[model samples]
Target: MNLFVEGFAWIFDPANYSGGQGWIVRLLEQLAYTFGATAIALLIAVPLGYLVGHTGRGRDLAVSFSGGFRALPSLGVLILLGLGLGIGFKAPLLTFVIIAIPPILAGAYAGFEAVDRKTIDAARAVGMTEWQVVTRVEIPLGLPLLIGGIRSSLLQVVATATLAAYVSGGALGVFIFDAFATRNYPEALGASILVTALALVLEGIFALLQKLVVPRGVVAKELKDVRQRSSRPLAAAGVPAQEGK
Candidate 1:
């Protein structure tokens, strides 16, 4: 309790708000690192993932790569890269990009896979070109899952960006690591709180984005499922089910 109180107090203190080393500045740096990494990862992963999902070629390879990438340890990779590249933005950026790729890739391919085969067949039957089918049918229907992947990747990137400080890339982790080294518990805790808060904020924002981007039919189907699930309990208890007019 005292630790949390002290941490919150430290965060709100006016003295901590000004310098280049300020929490706000560190937060912005962290956001830049996270966003930059995610954008690059999306550019690389999404297109390939979509291509694999659309063509059904190279899928096994993509799946293998996604699994392999996820199994890697971000910290170990960062350290190895730093040793090889010798401590610069390159190491941290590579580390962040590597960590962010798998989920986005998986999401893109899996999203397409999740679309009904019949729907895809129908699109083809309608004389749509392969490109048109992918863009018009698969992409729209698979959007929810695609965004889900982006959400997962974004969250992972945000959390992993803290490792940037290890390479002197400058982020909120600096506060935590620096304070901890000096035994400044309040500052360390405060930095931790800020990181957690930032992650949550990003999560909420992405969740809203996911909701907004999902196709209307998908949203309707989800709502219908929710309604049915809610009515199941009433049916189990022998209550009369209400019918929609």
Candidate 2:
């Protein structure tokens, strides 16, 4: 109980931050590493997913490979890479990328596949190039799923990123690691609380993004029941107004 109180006190110490002279730099550093890795992973996964799903080729291979990647323990992979890479954030960043890609890729592919075939055929019939069809038709239709996948990836990466501090990559992990090392249970618990807060914030942002990016049609579909109920009264009154007009 004493340790917890002291840890909370230390967390409020301004000097722990980069601007102040504390370990806050470690948190920023880890954030950079995780975001960078996720960016790279998404770049590769998104396009590949689109291609596989759109072409209806090697989809099983793609999905299976992603599953295999997910099956590999991140810590185990990081441990091996740390031996070769010489203990830094890179190895763990790579591990996170591997872990994060599967869902994004699978979601993108599934989204593309879910796009109506008739819609695609219509696009092609209207003189859309294959590229145009993909961009204008398939991707737009699949965007909801793709965004959901990305949101999931972002949440996953944020949670896993705390582990980066394990190899001196610098992150919120430092607080936990150092606290535990010195038997400071309060500090360790504080670090966990911060990480959880961050995860929740990330999830919230993605949820907002999903809502903002989803097509109006989807939104309309969601409101269809409400619309039907509301319209009945208005429609009944509307006839009287129209007659007056």
Candidate 3:
């Protein structure tokens, strides 16, 4: 209780809000690092993932790479890269990008895969060009999953960005490692709280995005399933089941 109180107090302390080392500055730096690395990874992964999913080519390779990257120890990768490349933005950026790729890649291709093939064929049967089918039909239908992928990547990149401080890479992580190094537990906890809150905010935003992108039919089916499942128990109990939610 005391620790949490002090932690919140630390966050609100006006003295901590001034100059280059201020919470706002650090938070911005963190966002910059996160967005930069994620953008790079997405540019590389999404196209490749889409190719695999769309043409059904290179899926084995995508899965293998995704699994490998997900299995990587982020901290160890950062340290090794630093040892090889020296402690600079390169190491941290590479580390962030590598770790960030899998979720986004998986999401991209998996999103496409999740689309019904018959729908895609129907689009083709309608005399839609390949490009038209992809842009008009596939992408729209696959959007919810694609957004989900971005959400996962954002969470991942943000978390991994914290490890950047290890390589003198800047971000909200400075508060964490720096504070812990000095035995400032309250400050560390406060910084950690900020990171958690940031992640949760991103999650909430993307969750809404996912919901918004879901086709209405899919949502209706999901709701219908839920209502039916709910009514089943009542039916089994010999209670009158409500109809038409």
Considering lDDT, which of the candidate structures 1 and 2 is the better prediction for this target?
1
| Candidate scoring better on lDDT of 2 and 3 | 3
Looking at model 3, residue 121 earns an lDDT score of 90
Number of the top TM-score candidate: 1
Which regions in candidate 2 have their CA more than 4 angstroms from the true location?
A: 1-7, 18-23, 221-245
Residue 11's C-alpha lDDT in candidate 1?
Answer: 96
Residue-level error in angstroms, candidate 3, position 71: 1.3
lDDT of 1 by residue, 16-111 (tens): 856898999999988998899999999999898999898888889988988887778889999899888887688988888888888888999988
Ranking by lDDT: 1, 3, 2
Backbone clash total for model 3 is 0
The per-model lDDT (C-alpha) reads: 0.88, 0.78, 0.83
* Best lDDT among the predictions, by candidate number: 1
How close is every model to the real structure, measured as TM-score? 0.88, 0.82, 0.86
What is candidate 2's lDDT per residue for 95-161, written digit by digit as tens? 7888778888988999998776888899999999999998888888898888888888877788888
Worst 10 residues of 1 by lDDT: 221-230
lDDT of 3 by residue, 1-245 (tens): 89999989989997775678888888887788778888998899888778888998888888898787767799999999999998768998898888778888888888788778899999999999999987888777777777777888889888878888888877788889989889999999898888888888878988988898788866664465453356677889998887764
- Backbone collisions counted per model: 0, 2, 0
